[model samples]
Target: MKRNIAVVWGGYSSEIVVSAKSMAGICSFLDEEKYNIYKIRITKEKWTVEVGGYVYTVDKNDFSYICPISDQRIYFDFAYIIIHGTPGEDGRLQGYFDMLGIPYSTCGMMASALTMNKFICNNFLKNFGIRVADSLYLNKDTKYNLRGIEEKLKFPLFVKPNTGGSSFATTKVKAVDQLQQAIDAAFGETPDVIIESFISGREVTCGCYKTKDKEVVFPITEVVTPNEFFDYEAKYEGQVEEITPARISGEMTDEIQRLTRKVYDLVGAKGLIRVDFIISDNQPFLLEVNTVPGMTQTSFIPQQIAAAGLDIKEVLTEIIENEFNAI
Candidate 1:
């Protein structure tokens, strides 16, 4: 019997565009003969499934819907969450799935919540001896002291929404005069903003996932962008060069892979996750952990999987089956 799988995508954030691309990539990679795939589109307006030019509404009560053609109630056995932002990325959707006793393809509620907020996640990891850049966290209600901020962190700081992704409303401030404007821009995305001192070095990212039987860590990818940083344009607009099996020493690559595994275990993460880092003076500094990393054909995870000489369909099968095996 084929299990019904709901590939959930879209969110209430700007990353929804990226999510659409990931949705396409995931649907293409999934094994059609083994499982029944349903494309669930989530938006601020509705949760629906469109099939053969017909649309059916999802029953949020059970995460299901009535098949338009067969007039039969279809319930999803598993949910492949590809939504890049809340309520999918921030644990809200995880809580809903938990209530329905449905398995998903991302981190659980606690890990998702912790990682969505970059400020808290990085600080929490810092206590575990993960090297991170100095940063300050601020909320909309908090009174920020510009002079104190400048005194603590040097120039060329990065200002970004503490709770979102896809580099939306993220800015690089090279001077104290540009700091306020950057923070304001970030605030437009979320109520909380994070200001971190820049790390001048090579930017690299690694992807990993572990099952009960084995751990799989992918090849590291070096990101070289002529832009100020790896912003939205560089990530999705083909403005960046991504080199897999990064041009680094063998020892450094091994250490990075080791740290990637450690971080995955630390956060109790499930499914595919990516960790970004910056190497400065031969030391790797943790940037942020992506629990619901992008799965687009051009995204980092797929690229890393290819470099590892692994099949995407096999990887997806392993992830989906791992959840069932655990139960």
Candidate 2:
């Protein structure tokens, strides 16, 4: 029997369109023989599932939708969530799926909620001896204290929302003059903001996957954005240059892989995850881990998978198959 897999995408997040695009890429490459695919769009009120040339818009409140085939209701064997930010990445949708007793890819509620907040997540991991950049958290309630923050971290700081992806409101401030403007831009994205000491080094990302037996780490990829920094446009606008198997020494590669596995285990992540890092002075500093990394063709995960000489379809299929065994 072909297992029903719901590729859930589109949410009330800023990355809705990007999520939809990722779903399209995933659906296109998924093997048709092993599983039945459903491109499900998650809106405020309904869960629209599309499969086998038919569409069913189901009321999420009641879990009722028009059956494509017979009158019987359809339940998915697994939900492959592709939503990048907001509710999807923030654990709301994961909790909903948990209530429905459905298996989904990525971290659970606690980890998702924790990691979604960049400042909190980094600090939490720092307790594990992970070296994260020095950061200060800002919110609407707090007064703007630039001098205090500057005392702790020097100029050329990175300011971004506490919870967002694709660098939606990320800014790199070179001096004190740009501090307020950077804070305002980050605040525009979310009520919470994070200002961190900038590390001048290569930007690298490593992808990790958990199988039934062992954890696998893909090659690290260095990101070179045309922009001064890897901002929102550089991420989604096809202007950044990414090099797989980053031109680092074998020792650096091994160290990064070890750190990636450590972080994955620390966060209790399952299925697929991507960990971002900054390499400075021959040391890899932990940046953040992405539980639900983008699955588009241009995404870093796909590039790493290809660089590892594995087929993307096979990797994704393995992830779905391992969902039941993942803790």
Alpha carbon lDDT at 262, candidate 2: 93
- How close is every model to the real structure, measured as TM-score? 0.98, 0.94
What would the per-residue lDDT of candidate 2 be over residues 139-212, giving only the tens digit for each residue? 99988678877888898789998998878878888888889988998888888999999888989999999888
Over 1-327, each residue of candidate 1 has an lDDT whose tens digit, in order, gives 999999999899888999999999999999999999999999989999977777889988989898766889989999999999898989999999999999999999999999999999999899999999999999989898887888888887899999989999999988888889888989999889999999999999999998879999999999999999999999999999999989999999998999999999888899999999999999999999999899888889999999999999999999999999987
Model 1 ranges off by over 4 Å: none
lDDT of 2: 0.85
Q: Pick the candidate with the highest TM-score.
A: 1
